[model samples]
Target: MAWVALIIAGLVETVYAAALERSATFTRLWPTLVFLAGVSVSMLGLAIAVRTIPIGTAYAVWVGIGAVGTAIYGIAVLDEPATAARLGCLLLIIAGVAGLKLLH
Candidate 1:
C-alpha cells in the first residue's frame, strides 16, 4: 500500500508539473493551487515510504520513478522532446529503479 501510494503520488506530481508548465501566466491561482496540493501529496508519500524503506533506496527509487514518469508524460501529452537521447535517459532511470528494487 505504501508503494502504491508513492507511485500514485509520483504520477500526480507529473500531471501537476505538466499543468504548471502549460499555465502560461504562472499567476493562475487555481492551477498553482492544484500544483502545490500535488507537490504536498507527493512529498507526504515520500516521507511515508522512507519510514519503512531505506532512505537511500527509497529516495533513489522515488526520484527515478518520478523522472521517468514525468519525462514520459511530457513526451506523450505535452509533445515535449521525443528525441532518442531523452528516451535513453528514461530507460536508464527505469533500469536504476529496477536495480534498486531487485537488489534491495
Candidate 2:
C-alpha cells in the first residue's frame, strides 16, 4: 500500500512538473491551479509512502520516476530532442529504479 502511494506520488510529480512549464511561471490560471493541486497531492502521497519506505531509497525512486516521465513527456509532446545519449541515460535511470525495487 505504501509502495502504491509512492508510485502514485511519483507519477503525480510528473504531472506537476509538466504543468509548471505550461503554467508559464504561474502566469496561466488553470495550469497554475493544476500545478498547485498536483504538488499538494504528490507531497501527501510521498509523506504517506515514507511512513513505510526508507527515506533515501524512496526519495531516489520517486525522483527517478519523475525524471524519466518528464523527459519522455518532453520528447513526445514538447518537441524536445530525443537523442541516443539522452535515451540511454533515461534507460539507466529506469534500470537503477528497478534495481532499487528489486533490492528492497
Candidate 3:
C-alpha cells in the first residue's frame, strides 16, 4: 500500500507545515514538539512510499498534495484569503495530483 503511505505522508506534510508556523520560530515548546514529531512520521511515510514508487512521480505528488492541503488548511482554519483565484489554483493542483495518480 505504498500509495496509501504516500497519501498519508502528503497529509502529514501539511500538518508539519502548520505546526511549524505554530511553533513561532521554535519558541513554542508544544507546537515545536508537534512539528518535530510530524516531520519524523511524514519522512518515514515518504521513505516507505519511495521504495516502490518512482522518485520523480512520488516527489511531485507529495509536493502537490502538501501545497494544496496546506493552502486549504490555511484558508479554512487560519482565516487566510479565500478568493476565487486562490481556490482555483488549488483545484489546478488537485487536478495535477490526480493526473499523476491516474497516469501512474
Candidate 4:
C-alpha cells in the first residue's frame, strides 16, 4: 500500500540522516555509501507513495516521522541532550503526524 511505502520511506529517512552524520561529510567511505544507499531507497519509496497520496500530506508525514525518529535516536544512542522541552516537542510532532493521518 502507499501508506506502507510512505512509512518505510520515512524510516529510511532516519537511517540516512544518521548515516549523514556518521559520514563526516563523505570523508568516511562506508558511511558515505550507506548514506547514498539510504537516500536512494528513501526517495524511491517516497516517489511511489506520492503516486497515491497527496504531496502536501505525504511530504509532511514523511518529514515528521524522520525528524522525530532521528531526534529520538540522537538522544538515546548518540548522547545528545534529552531535555524535557525536546521530548515535549517530539511529542507534539507525533501528535501532528497522527492528526494528519486521521484527517487523511
lDDT of each: 0.79, 0.94, 0.92, 0.95
> TM-score for all predictions?
0.86, 0.97, 0.96, 0.97
Q: Tell me the tens digit of each residue's lDDT in model 3 across 8-53.
A: 9999999999999999999999999999998999889889999999
Cα lDDT, model 4, residue 54:
90
Worst 10 residues of 3 by lDDT: 54-63
lDDT (tens digit, per residue) of candidate 4 on 1-104: 99999999999999999999999999999999999999999999999999999998899999999999999889988999999999999999999999998998
Considering summed lDDT, which 10 consecutive residues are worst modelled in model 1?
A: 17-26
| TM-score attained by model 1 | 0.86
Tens digit per residue, CA lDDT, model 2, 52-72: 989888998999999999999
Estimate, for each residue in 1-104, the C-alpha lDDT of model 1 and write its tens digit.
66776667667777678667765567878888877787888898888877777878877887777778778888888789899998988898889888988887
What TM-score quantifies how close candidate 2 is to the native fold? 0.97
* Model 4, backbone clash pairs (residues 3+ apart or across chains), number: 0
The global Cα lDDT (0 to 1) of model 1 is 0.79
Better of 1 and 4 by lDDT: 4
Q: Could you tally the backbone clashes for each prediction?
A: 0, 0, 0, 0
